[model samples]
Target: MKPTLKPLAEQVIVITGASSGIGLATACAAAEAGARVLLIAREDKDLRPIVAEIVASGGTADAFAADVGDAARLRAAAAHAVQRFGRIDTWINGAGVAIYAALRETPAEEHEQLFRTNYFGTVHGCLAAIPHLERGGALITIGSIAGDMPSPLMGAYAASKHAIKAYVEALRMELGEAGLPISVTLVKPSGIDTPIAQHAANHEPGEAQIPPPVYDPKLVAQAILHCATHVKREITVGGAGRAQALFAAHFPALFEVLAPKAAASFIDPARPQPRPDNLFASVRTGRIRSGEHHARRTSFYTTAAEYPGTTAVIGVGLAAGLGALIASRHRTRH
Candidate 1:
């Protein structure tokens, strides 16, 4: 049986990594929509003010402090959510960390920690949320375009996302075969303007910056909320990301040849030196968007992907327009 997910106002959501970035953006948006939100993160200090702000705005929100890397602590947070809010209708595994360094340069311990938080954290969340969601609900995990297309410098981070994509897909199949009422979705976003770059453990000579054509964190939040109500298998937020994935898949040799040229853009020596990173632990939190670059406010491809019939019509229109332009040019030349 397919799961009948509840509307935003009727649902209770637990968001890990809710202190910053996509997670924080989602939490705030969910609360604004009248969902009971449980904000989980390593820092209770950062969460407290955000929760208070949400409460002050007439939203139901509570803060839970825990590292998603710790299964015991994560499970405890899940229990607390159940205790605070009768039931969980949606559980978003958004907790993740990044390392801006080559695999060779990164220490063995850093790579392990990245996997523990990014990959295993999702595993723990899925296990912990399944029991509560048996009635019917959504399990959404934040993945990345890097999951589909491996990146340099951030190889470890990309690998973790790739693992997450695989794990989430497998879990979905297992649950579907068992006929459970659960909606499992993987949200793979492109370069989102979040604090991740700032928080990354940078080993390069300069500070880290998300590559250009960054989308606002709200775009990811929008996608997450949409998946909460609608049953979707996967959603990639940016068109540029989807395009790159396609290019990499279709022409791997060429992609490999050209991809390295963009690696230098990932670092910026002009930015302030020695920025604080959160590879080992949480540094600071509470902000959503990184103001480093101008972010695109909307994604046409993402919106079109959500509505297939519309995309089809748009595709046909583009084809007809191209045909007309070509014919007109040919006639003029003749």
Candidate 2:
């Protein structure tokens, strides 16, 4: 079921990777909902406009420059939020990188980079905010559907998500027992039609291959706000994302059958290095497109991100599973 817009007069939220895509869209939505928004990205290069946009819309927002992978930076951002907003009621980490490589061929550096951005980045946000995070606040992580099932070429990204799931689940359990309002949430988006695919890292020369999926980014963004309004413990956003998550849980045989085809779409060529382009990158989508039934966020216990096989994730998720269709940095005529 779809959820109606809720008021956010007294809420404050900090979102990482707010310069573009899901992070950017979500920041806009949060501000419109009446919350005081804190935006953080790896650089100030793209933040000024975002900050100005929010402020111009009769909402409150501020941008801070910081890399999600940097613990020190996140700490400072978190500290800044408290001092500026008086308190932080919500935290969302949307910064991520999709690297192409096989389990054996995947380099230690790439693995570390993916983990830093996808996994530990979330961790840093949580850790930095925990002390001042407030008992009644919420912690939200933007995870992929790949976390549950094994994707062929995108192993590291999936692995990082698995790690995130493990951490958030445990955090939820602990917080529940502690009777704290500090609820933990994981948002698993399907093929968000976002520019994440465009920005994804390719193999050096020839690495591996995979298939692509599709979904809407704004839908994912709306679903996120859905969670924030109600603050559900965990939510899988959108239709395809939910299906992929279900595949990991209820139907392994089907997952195995479909996994390789999706993987081969991106990484099976076994090239000496990675391919720079995302074969499944969709046609440019810009301007306001209206559609019925804006996707809803539910308290549904959807599946966790889990693509163990390296190849499966690359194709099915990186290529096939698209979530948001918006790209702040795209060259499309707006």
Backbone collision count in every prediction?
0, 57
Error of 1 at 215 (Å): 0.5
The lDDT for every candidate, in the order shown, is 0.93, 0.69
Q: Which candidate is the best by lDDT?
A: 1
* Candidate 1 C-alpha lDDT tens digits along 1-334: 8999989999999999999999999999999999999999998998999999999999999998898988989889889999999989999999999998888899999999999999999999999899999989999999999999878888999999999999999999999999999999999999999999988888888889897779989999999999999999999999999999999999999989888788789999877634667877787788898868799989998998687788999899999999999999999999
Model 1 worst lDDT run, 10 consecutive residues: 271-280
lDDT value, candidate 2, whole model: 0.69
Superposing every Cα of model 2 onto the true structure, what RMSD results?
Answer: 13.6
* lDDT comparing candidate 1 with the true structure: 0.93
- Candidate 2 minimal-lDDT segment of 10 residues: 281-290
| Native-to-model Cα distance after best TM-score fit, residue 254 in candidate 1, in Å | 1.0
Return the top candidate by TM-score.
1
- The estimated TM-scores of all candidates read 0.94, 0.75
Extract clashing residue pairs from model 1. none
For residue 31, model 2's alpha carbon misses the true position, in angstroms, by 1.4
